[model samples]
Target chain A: MILAYIGLGNMGYIIAGHIADKLKQDGEPTLLVYNRSNAKVDALIADGKHVQSASIDHIARHADIIFTCMFNDEASKQIIGKDMIGSGQMKHGAIIVEQATIRPDTAEFLASIANEKGLHYLTCPVMGAPPRATAKLLVPLLAGNPAQRKIVRPYLENVIGKVVVEVGDSPGSALRLKLCGNYIIVTMVEMIAEALTLGEASGVGQNKVQELLAGLFAGTPVTDYAQRMTDETYDDVRFSLDGANKDTTYILDLAEKSNADIPMAKVFKNHLDKLTSDYPSLDISGVVGVVREASGLPFNLKKA
Target chain B: MILAYIGLGNMGYIIAGHIADKLKQDGEPTLLVYNRSNAKVDALIADGKHVQSASIDHIARHADIIFTCMFNDEASKQIIGKDMIGSGQMKHGAIIVEQATIRPDTAEFLASIANEKGLHYLTCPVMGAPPRATAKLLVPLLAGNPAQRKIVRPYLENVIGKVVVEVGDSPGSALRLKLCGNYIIVTMVEMIAEALTLGEASGVGQNKVQELLAGLFAGTPVTDYAQRMTDETYDDVRFSLDGANKDTTYILDLAEKSNADIPMAKVFKNHLDKLTSDYPSLDISGVVGVVREASGLPFNLKKA
Candidate 1:
């Protein structure tokens, strides 16, 4: 069996590299790679991995299983339809697993189309950033038919992530999960920023509050993010604020659709939206900057 | 020296207790106390600690130093004016320290009146809840006459809190600090709540996100609060949502006075306001319940 992987952004690139390493070690399936950017594909190829196709159609035709890791739903649909499905590159009963963060409705629509073509489509978005992906510590949330999951089990067992949580058989379950996860991150950022500002105002010192919180509850991403806010350190953008804000907006839209009262999320979204203006060039952690500005305090003071 | 303490609420009671304990051990200053309910004072009196006065005036007439830890600015002003200043119970140059969380302007006004009476006054509001106060781990943000601070240094150093940060000479400085610190907590509650909902929606599991954030940044309050949110375990209120909302509103008011853009704080206040309606009796951590509601999920569901 051969696995076809498309897209080579930060997440996609790292995931594809892991797959190649897994194939070489496991010897159960070969790795086939294709990226819209030929340089990225060539770069991966130079690492001595198999290059199955320069185009999406070639990847679909040559590999039994296809995995997509892209920016959003639109990109995923474009590559899969224009280059793979529309070109009749996929064989009967071929499986497609998506790892991008996308809207639930889009994933379901794509899945239905795949079903008509006798293709098995699974939504399998991932958790963790680029660093975790490189370290094989990413978490994968998969949703699809039992048989399709079984067919890809060998390839997915260790290649992509540390844990694979099966959300459901619905195609959009994975996407929903991913979107939800992003929502949590933005909320964390917003709170960290506000807390840090408050701590400084109280004369407790931001560093002390950061230390106290981290010590009390040391096993949370929000705490790690809190430290960053307290220190005003936002250089290493594992997740950009703009991305977070966008995800939060999407969640808000979801909440609106359901007519659910999400005052907390709505508040968080407002923070992120304002953050774009406060620290125009800073990372998402810059939300803290807005807090400081509002309290008549400097976000970060220069050491005298 | 004799120290008279007032206001035996959650935080006040612990602080007064600590001072009494210290005075007992040192065998220097005598401890006097008063409260509206008087039960806690009666208990302390029963424990052989010095107790005095049906009103603040009695303490002011008898004690060398008068310390108060009331609910807000109005209460602090009322206790000082009706029982001490207006009653002519204060001794010339006797030091009075206010430890309530009040508006900065109120603190300044109270300080001015104390100054007119030839009494030394210090605005010395503290950080930390009842638990921290009980442990004598609270941080005090103090502002007032340097001479008065020096006079009370021995006792304040011995019992009240762990650290005393000198914010400014202005009467309102300490109150400002307190407001700023609480702004942080309220901001954190809003952010963490939103994140919990998002994480649940994404299938990452709220507990998982909490765990990840805590481990990564274990010293942040964000993690501690986020963990409470993830577990939905906030029965015993360390801090109530109503109280937190009040503080946030106060902070926003201060922000308005400074002409500061505290949009994040406004968002936090709004969330807390809404949370009061949904989880009327739930603790501040129950803000996460609002998030879960937005996600179309139960507020207290365990991961399968």
Candidate 2:
């Protein structure tokens, strides 16, 4: 089976590289790769283990199982909807596995569109950032028809994901799970940011708070994000503020449509919106800067 | 040196028990114990390890170092203020080490009163619930004068706490750190509740979300609280709803006083306030029940 990966951004590039590396270990000739920009594709091809597709349609026409990892619902819709990779372009019974964090409804909508065109679609949005993807440690939340899941399970387990959880038969279930996971992460970021800000404002050293978090609140998003905020190195941008804002918006929209009250999402959305407006280039961890400013501390105060 | 423990709520009882156990191991003759009601004191004395003090004043006068782990600032104030364990009651240079979750200002005020009474004071609020306290795994955030911290560090390290973080020399800094840590935990409980609600509402399984949280958000406040939430067993009240609301209020008041824009804290306080009004007897994890109700689910949906 020809395997392809599209949208070679930070997370996607690392994920695709891992998949390519796995396929190469099995003595596969090459994996198909595509991206809007050429640099990532050029870099992958330069490594000499994968072949770059000329366009998304090239990937659609050639690859049996294609993975798309985009930034948001709009990007996913543009790629899988009529605008690009139209239903007729791909081989019949081709599988489109989506790993982008998008609205559950959008995943269902895209799945329906794929079904009408004789293409099998699966939503398998993953948990973890770029580093985990690079290490092939991303956890996949899988949702599709049982048959479709069976066909994709080997690839997910062997090539891409370390752990794959089958959420349900509905394509949207995986996306919902993805949003739930991202909601935890995003909310955790804001929570830790506020925590550090409160600690600093109250004259508790950030190092002490960081140490306590590492000991008590260790092994989760708390320590990871708290470390970033304490270091004030927001420019590294493993997950960009814009990307985090997108996921938060997706979560809020999902909550509204599902009649769920996620008040923290609303608050987080406002904070991200305000922060992104002020510093569009800042990492999502930069939300700490907003909390610091509110506490009458200079944004990104240097630690003594 | 005579050591005393006051307050015997869920957390305090276990913590005081651990200290008594340590004292017994060290061949110390007795530990001074006090509570408003006689039941807990009776129970501790029934264990045949510790001695019960007649009153808070008795503890103040007899014990060289006293640990107070009350529910709130008012209780702490009453215990150490002029009304109860007054300045003239305790021996000179006696130390009052507070472990209650209270406002930073209250800690400072209590410290000042202790100082005026020729006593040394330290705020050493602990993190963790009853189980952790029982296991002697509680993390303590300690702040006081250098000399006082030195006097108390041996007891903290030997008997009560697994990790002790000296936040600063300022007496209020430790309370602020404790509040910050509790803020992370309380907000995490709410965030996990909202995420679970959103996931369940969007047709994702609660078990799936719980599993994902256990794996990705493991070891932090998220997994422990999310497990309690998904189990719908909020009544095992390790931390009561009222107590959580109290901590949330302390965090919000601290944020406001420090000019920190912790919008999440404001939202969480409102949720806890609403939840406590309805299910005053529920566990803090019952904050999940509030989110579940907001999402139109029953307060405690039985897991299949």
Among these predictions, the greatest DockQ belongs to 2
Question: For model 2, what is the C-alpha lDDT against the true structure?
Answer: 0.81
Model 1 Cα displacement at B234 (Å)?
8.3
The candidate 2 chain A region of ten consecutive residues with least summed lDDT is A48-57
Backbone atom clashes (below 3 Å) for every candidate: 24, 0
Give the per-residue Cα lDDT of candidate 2 at B178. 84
Q: What DockQ, on C-alphas, does every prediction get? A: 0.22, 0.70
Q: Which runs of model 2 end up more than 4 angstroms from their true locations? A: A48-58, A72-75, A82-89, B48-58, B83-89
Tens-digit lDDT string for candidate 2 (B170-286)? 888888888888887887778888888888887786788898888886656667888888878887887877677778778888877878778888877877888888989988888
